[model samples]
Target: MIDLSSCLSESAIQISDRTSCSKNSNVSCMISPNSTPSTQNTVTCLYRTILSTRKKILITVTWSKNSLSQGLSITIGEDPSISFKVNTNPRLFRKLKGSKSLEFQGCKVEVFWDFSSARYRSVHEPEPDDGYYIFITFDSELGMFLGDKARETLQKQEKSGPRMAKFSLITRHEHFSGNSHYQTRAKFCETGAAHDILIRRSGELEGRKNSELSVSIDKKTVIRVRSLQWNFRGNQTIFLDGLLVDLMWNVHDWFCNPDSGHGVFMFRTRSGRDSRLWMEEKILHKDEKEEFSLMIFAACKNM
Candidate 1:
């Protein structure tokens, strides 16, 4: 079991009347699998519900002199996270502004980036990950800011690969603990060819849960399948044992299966065009050796 009861140990300003987890039993959270907030919110309602001793966040709420909007409440923690209680949205949110503070939940919360932590990859490439980050709460109800990268990356692919050949991974759900079910031979974390940056959006997806392993290789050329690309629509599932799972991540996944290794899965691409699936691995579900057959275009091309 991944334990993460220590990340939020330090508190800048303490909330005196805060309820204790030793007494209550409802506010428990853990560090996600990737150990970064960007991976996944491992701390879920179920985690709280299952814990013997519920964990609760102790916070300070001081109303500031200058207030912008009455409806929004930003909770700033000295740990670089500023939680918000905007009257608009309620899913989960954080933004990309430099160090600053924001008001939330009827109190003035300070904002700053926590650079003490180790360096990790940022899902939104192009955006430099030179330093650490601060957590900010946003109105998920109003709109979202985290998803812009995925959309932008999708648009830049044509300049990266050949036509009717390349496509990108879009994460819809990101949670760990389901892939192991289907992949009895292997665990779920080793499903696709994505970086750890994904944990933030999908919470450390375990078993291809979120089809959002989005990529940004935008050169119009050939992309070897270094990873398994999971199709989100229906039963179009890819597996190691499920399909050419070993072929893609063989450099890493080969430790387990040596003899039956997959060659490579390549795709062609052009920007703003549909992507096709190309397979070169000897061990595959079917055969597509021919040039035209090697090109698997999208079912619906973008007009």
Candidate 2:
């Protein structure tokens, strides 16, 4: 089993040795006494994709929204030293559609995006469910498609040279504020089903003396944390679709500082059988290629 003590930061959370949940679990305690409030609202998705150069690179698509600003950003490669980036705001473009051509790592790259007719499940979600397409072409040899309008984009562009690019989702990071009940979806593997994830916190309910936290997947309660004030930070292991998933949460801010307090939850699964081993220093290893991570940062102003 992976040690949650070395994985979590002591400044943010303390390690708990208490055994809660199931037998295959490691629970760490959380208590950030001076955690400040967070007002960020954004969603970022990182993908591990290969270009025509046969080299691996990472692509980051980010959407950010605040009271006065809302925009989209796409960044290629690991660093800004040699990358292709596009930043656009809906209010400024009105159409929310455009294309840009650039060179990345000595290869010709083209980016096309159309969100004018996109549909969103919620205002908090920056990614659209349908009626949108974001395409990235490398040397006109391969293309990466995001969204559901690949066919529409192909027919309109009439470019038959670039095939589809093979990519793997690395991690999804989201920041949301407002309520205690948060819901999202995650797919542990490429061939696995996308499971509905719900995180809820109950405060001094009818039968409960202190707040409690529960994590559910596909409507099934998988992990529960009791006496949340004392165990605000912890980790658990659960099996899903025959694979082991590491679950971690830190809600110290939610209880200690509610005005702008933020809580964090993470669901991670590895492609290797030794998923029991974790990165002591970093989230990824130099050779460990296939890992899926979902991180949620939720804040509540009222509870």
Candidate 3:
């Protein structure tokens, strides 16, 4: 079932998964509040007639500022490919850092966010449903919103830390598809002089594509990872809120595989961010296709 009024309305609807069905999406519409739905009505009438005849209406959304421009064309299928761009509102960033704040350096860090990707078993015709895949790239080069306390911790370690092998403590959050969407967008916070964190990814790109999707919904994700690395004897002040605070930690890497049973890393994070922090690597070699799997795991610690 589809209701054009919900998403098209002035505010958000109670719907959980807006674009859940592909065929059920019948009305290809572009309802801009600033613009009129004049010519669109004719197209809608014919679409309804087609739906009545064919019993399926695969709708697409396209619009433009000029003559019903189709600059933004998004198809809706079982796994639709959507692409669009807009001038995003900067209120949130301004809210967190104050109106005049611009840079992210030396702020308080309370929590650590992460953006990581793990491949899942690909879907095959014989099996049809092996496992779906998803990729999360944190928007920030550093971690998410961590206030003053986080800034203080990382600076001390960046200056005079031991020269042992570099180990790391990584903080991972739950999959962003759930309620995590309501959390916070990704941003780099370097409140301390030197914290052992690296940016393998930074949130999503300009486009969003899924490998195997049962639904036609388009998803956007934001993530953060708190990682501690070792061996840095320099100016290590955490950077955030357009200021610099002191915080740094030495994170280590502990690996595991099917050959070896498993390894446990110290846990650090809140209940929401702590879930599924580690995904152990699994190796399977039987048929023409050799496969690998990763387990998600995370730990929380007080610095």
Candidate 4:
């Protein structure tokens, strides 16, 4: 979790609700894993769901890929040490589809996945584009469904009737290693539109003494940092889909140590309560309403 209170309050700006994005906002892309020439790619999606016991639990699905193989891991609420993982490319486990039974906080949970025919937009992406399904069940009820083959998966289940899952995506975390230019897609709010998010840093390429940072949404630049060396850590506010998005970045490592330093960027929406309060370590596990946030960790090799 990020302590965005200081960042958002220090550089908050006032913007009218009438502000609109680019006319090409209609265009959208798949929320795939980050891309890099040579590095491990990993993406984790967190969801808040309710069990039959009325207990709220957080489920995290992490997809990862490296030079060796591809992997998938599922963990319950905040603890990564205890998890159920699947290696998609194991010599002993040649099968591409399977099911697992696990217990969490005394509640029984079942996870099902199939990736034999999974498709991908790019070879470097960890998650698939289509032709797959990942489902979670609690007390014989569907708790969550992912992928494009939902209808087909439900038909094959043993349950006669399936009920909808009361779940929402709370946050997403991604890691990538490459140049300063980073691209991904996101939906600021649950009911809002998904826009293209691009972050770029350039100074050496332009023959300038100081580097600059720019953020673009839907092909339109929304935030720019003219002197990145002086202001390597900062925040800005932007309006999207009638919501206020607080964006913060810390690229201190990129300037201080260019060899093996990573940058952290965060984009969170302001709703009923401050994101800082809800993101506290204690509050994250407690029962709470839905909130969306995106966190990016970029490792710049040749900035």
Which scores better on TM-score, 1 or 4? 4
Ranking by TM-score: 4, 2, 1, 3
In model 4, where is the ten-residue run with the lowest total lDDT? 22-31
**Tens-digit per-residue lDDT, 106-217, candidate 1:** 5333333332321323331111233433332222111111233323443677566222212111111112221211000112222423311111112122343432322111
Give each model's whole-structure lDDT.
0.22, 0.67, 0.19, 0.71
Candidate 3, after superposition: displacement of residue 56 in Å? 56
Model 1 regions lying over 4 Å from their true place = 1-98, 114-124, 135-235, 239-303
Report the Cα lDDT for candidate 4. Answer: 0.71
RMSD of each: 25.1, 7.5, 28.5, 4.8
On residues 113-160, what C-alpha lDDT tens digit does candidate 4 reach at each position? 888778876777787878888888876778888888876766776476
Clashes of each: 45, 2, 69, 0
Residue ranges of candidate 4 with Cα displaced over 4 Å: 1-8, 22-40, 78-81, 89-93, 151-160, 205-208, 272-290
Best by lDDT: 4
Regions more than 4 Å wrong, model 3: 1-165, 169-171, 175-183, 186-303
**Candidate 4: residue 189 lDDT (0-100):** 73
The candidate 2 region of ten consecutive residues with least summed lDDT is 13-22
Question: At residue 218, what lDDT does model 3 achieve?
Answer: 19
